[model samples]
Target chain A: MKQKIRIGSGAGFSGDRIEPALILAEKGELDYLVLECLAERTIALAQKEKLANPELGYDPLLEKRLIGLLPLLARKKIRLITNMGAANPIAAAKKVREMLVKAGLNLKIATVTGDDVLEKLDLNELSLEGNKAIKNYPEIISANAYLGHEGILEALQNEAQIIITGRVADPSLFLAPMIHEFGWDTQNFDLLGKGTVIGHLMECAGQITGGYFADPLKKPVPGMETLGHPFADIFPDGKAIISKVNGTGGVVNLQTVKEQLLYEVINPFQYLTPDVAADFTTVKLHDLQNDRVEIRDGTGNKRPETLKVSIGYLAYFKGEGEISYAGTGAFERAKLAEEIIVKRIGNQFSEFRTDLLGINSLHKSTFGQDTIPYEIRLRVAGKARSIEDAKLIGEEVEALYTNGPAAGGGVIKRASEIIGIVSVLMNRKKINTQVTYL
Target chain B: MKLLEIAHSRAGDKGNISTLSLIPYEEKNYQLLCEKVSIEKVAAHLKNIANGKIERFELPHISSLLFVCHDALETGVTTSLALDSHGKTLSSALLEMEI
Candidate 1:
């Protein structure tokens, strides 16, 4: 058994900086460089792209990121794992194969599919938020179940250098590599949970580091401009140490790790994933020297019987317009503009919102009315059935330029289609995972 | 003193629920955080924007408190018409609350 293996995070999201990943590939001695680029709605967007062109369902930055890391990966013999395939893994794998061949690098690549369960799923069987039926929305663009580590482990076991997947769990991308290397059993819930905690911490790339840990003078992190990405050193026992690259500008302490541990998590005792039900409440973190923090004692119960499926549907057309007002009575003028808009195009839009940007936009009704601001931007947005109907909301707001509000400047208007998401639970037995190598 | 004086926070959204983790710089402040930052106080503080039930989880090992505010994002990120769809700035907004 290996004593320890290092896995570095390349990119956190789809559009994350690629240069930091190259730095890891070149300098950081890593067994695997995992890039978690898929977000909840990203695959849905990719599905739309796939509809336009069958060969373009993967992440837009896939080519750019590979162009930067392929050479270093080949040199270092570092394996690459990513969920950047989005809605299409085969096309992404093909693209990577073409890139590698062009560079004359004989690297093995694998793609995992079967997460796209749209066709197999019955809308009647699915429910969203207590009794809400999926059948109500007929415009579903994409439906994908969150796959576990089985497919990823299968790919690794086949000696694939690069593993690309679609709609796998974020932590699974990191955990699969650990499971394959350590020869860990799939049914070992405790080890799986422990490994998952490591994956979760390192999944956000720089969150465990200091990218999202800065607060100017309050909690200052050095080298904010070129923040370092995070990596984990996993031991045979499943305990791991989370740290960043040497000479990189980011802190890995209890505070940063703790903040990230609870990020996007609901119940501390039950962080549900396909592999394990991880209990992070008892997890401990010790700050070691050189920006390393040892994380231990992550326990788990049996895995959930069902998997969560993210379903994206065409919601409606959104029309938005923003116009700024300045000087003494700016708030009043913005309010007047909102009232005028409601009077003009209120019935046209199915649902709409008007906000005074500088005033009570974010924390609405939280702060009591006080002193009037020098400037206020009136933003009115609405959703309609059609693009032409949605455009009217923006048009009505633009009419305020000549129709009402005094000194309305910087008028910006836009109309676009909105994607709506619904979550449903699917039985684990229903979904099947497939792995293919190229 | 304000919450920002002693603690730092990060907020993230999953569907309509938004979770904010408040981690104190000093371990001693964990007790103070538990005392001052209650579910009621948090719900009251964000009463305007967050209209759902508030649940708090204590992670004493890490000296942090997590607040999960349901129905907080106006709606989900993809569906919400709000300016800050992900509610990323809610952590800073919550930090502004005086203790």
Candidate 2:
């Protein structure tokens, strides 16, 4: 009899840096371990690296993390799936193999690619649909598709304990085994969509369980140190429970599960998928027992005729400077200082763009939040299309220390310029994903 | 068959929405959607049944539609949907998406 398994990937904050998540599979107790090391900025970071090294689009930091765990995974022999490879899975796989060989651990790794149709695409032919206010750029920095769990199935078939991929749609890491184990077919679109929805719920590991959804009211899941990974227990009949590493501090109850289910769905029922669109809105969330929720009623739907392309490029050459203005009129003074400096900087180097971000959304997002009155600091940043333009803009902001306004004002303290970037805007399309698997 | 189901899902911590994956219409039915069906009719039907204010997102590339019933988020249930009061149309609605 095929046994049911529950596995969760590991992710935690260690002081100033984040530790790798794949380590949870090393416990010798998990069927699958998911790692989410890539974010929007991380995508841009990989693109920046590719500019320096043509074949280095995949983030090396994530690769370094994955490589470090090979020996432990091999020793324990755990099967896995991950989207650590940002753009090119093959290139990323080579790096992983190199790391494995260096560490004296031999492991089979597979790459899933062909998700990025951004470069060869013509934006004129695509539609933003109802989503407006989004801008499109002339060039693409990085474009990749969301390959579903098919890669994991192939890896398991080849006895590969670890599967590395460019950008497998997040849900497939959790759904692959279920499909393979249940003998579900590609034509079984409805069930496949359900499994995909289940995978989507657990992919974020912590976000769905309790890490992000813990109500601000209750004494939420405490002691996040040694946070547990997320896993699912799927039955042959088509229902599952999402859980995390045992004894891990988190709850997988109704609120948590529903939150996960809703994450990233622009629409509840017509949720698009590479394999099949899932009717997530129709689904039911049942608190089956302790720390468990049963999600049902999701009907499989058709995927969008277009694939979403996440494009990135240069925003400009940007520089940042931070400073403090204490006492009675600190906020007002800071606001004025920002406006004057921006206008002055614009006057100084008219060819660039200036963006000023303060701690309002960061420090505290809502009312009733109290920031120290006298400690308010005014920070300024400038970005331009050209390096010289950016430099001139930077010089303009720095000029505040000398001839600019607030130079000798009370608490006109500190500042510095930051590096700028050329921002890339992405457009999406729906086409039959073409792949020649080797 | 062309169908769109609009509902919300979580993206991260705060409630971000999710897209419900619906089965799409077929090859020969392309011209029929624009000529026969109207976005207003679908939006009206969904708005009447759903709980919260219906949020609608239209599409491009194809002449299809995405009608989301935005008002359902407040009900606080594991699963929720507002079925149209006219019960005879469900089979036709499923046929629209070709489910």
Candidate 3:
């Protein structure tokens, strides 16, 4: 008899919708549910929160997600894996324990820590961005290595019902269970590579579905508002089928799968996660009509010698302001408003830019025909050394209503500190992982 | 004809680089994409936004072309002051290229 496991993706990012995950838990009949919530700069901001309050630092919506899915997951006997423990896995695990007690469930939870390699990071190492020494960077906030599946595999071996981790590579969260359930060899690069292909495809829940694929007249998607996330049915032979829950709002086909296969990927022949150098070149996707796609033949080479570390540091404060102009001369008025801000405070900030919302904000450069519109919104933003200096850029833009342009209404302004992220490769031997049962 | 007529795209980011995937509506168009959508043309197309090198990779089986535009997303999503710091719209711009 062929053994198979069903895995569903709940939340794709930190701020993704809760309903899709609830739908998955309620209907997907999943063996494992994985929620990947961390982004590149998410933990650095969380580290700041942890510094302010010791009990803080996890995903803001972790409690809500558990409250929504725990009972359903418990009833279905679905194991859950998440990287929602952004900067503090221990604290996150404790919170989950409290939630389990409150829900009257006796699920064993585990926390995978030691992704925080801040102390272990060699300051002399060069950053992948500019090749600058780590010590030369400004006030460092967080340094986390992209951990593989070892810690997660350990948690599964300990019979954990729920595993929470910080800084585990997104694909690894999905790949760990395949290794645990199938008892696949650790050095089985081909199997791990196949698993990684599945992980990367499912990592963004709605992406492999129709969420990111719709174009007005060209490509049409059915139920975007109620778009259901995706799931995979895996076999012991390293083959998987990608699909979404039936009666959902999205389409799952070869197109969606292919788009996501290359999502955030540079080299398809060598997609390097912490686990394996997955080769998407040999992968084949067959759309089995009615929302089922069969994925086959994906393999990988040996894993990278070093793991990539995401280091966050306090960069600068960004101040921005936007105001609208209307009527026949709206374009000229918006242009004048932009000029006023530049002349007033351009020299105060290190970097500054102005964009007319409908005109050139996205591309930052003009493309297509130049036509004067009835309404245009002028946005002025700048990078400042300090918060106070950052505020000046917005202030100047807001002043245009009374001081510079006519009908510059709907003024909005904001200033926030920026946390910049850089990467450096560290020896995989240096990352000391620990898994603790909660 | 606009590349958008026969193909679709999605933009992705890692650090300062932007990755844009161009998949044709029909597999037959893959050859046209290979001939028209050269790295030089893409670099020229995104010259203003991405002031860096552009590399292209071909996926013959899938009939897709992946463009890795280096130094494209300003400094990065977190640090870049651009409204579209992730360069999510870069793919749309790529689709606007002539086929």
DockQ of each candidate, alpha-carbon based = 0.79, 0.08, 0.81
Model 2 scores a TM of 0.69
TM-score of each: 0.97, 0.69, 0.98
Name the best candidate (by TM-score).
Answer: 3
Could you tell me the lDDT of residue A247 within candidate 3?
A: 95
Residue A209 C-alpha lDDT in model 3: 85
> For all the candidates, what are their Cα RMSDs to the real structure?
1.5, 12.5, 1.1
The Cα RMSD of model 1 versus the native structure comes to 1.5
Model 3 score (lDDT): 0.90
Error at A184, model 3, angstroms: 1.1
Instruction: Report the CAPRI category for model 3.
Output: high
Give every candidate's TM-score on chain A.
0.97, 0.79, 0.98
When sorted by TM-score, best at the front, the candidate numbers are: 3, 1, 2
Query: lDDT for every model?
Result: 0.89, 0.52, 0.90
List, residue by residue over A121-211, the lDDT tens digit for candidate 2.
5444432321322235433455555556665777667766666666556666677777777787766768877787777777667766577
Which ten-residue region of model 1 chain A has the weakest summed lDDT?
A363-372
**lDDT tens per residue, model 1, A146-243:** 99999989999999999999999999999998999899888999999999999999889988888888777977889877888988889989999888
- Residue-wise lDDT of candidate 2 within B36-95, one digit each (tens)? 444455444343223344344433222223334443332211111111111222322322
Model 2 misplaced regions, further than 4 Å: A1-3, A11-23, A40-48, A123-136, A214-219, A288-290, A346-372, A379-383, A391-438, B1-99
| Best of the two (2, 3) by lDDT | 3
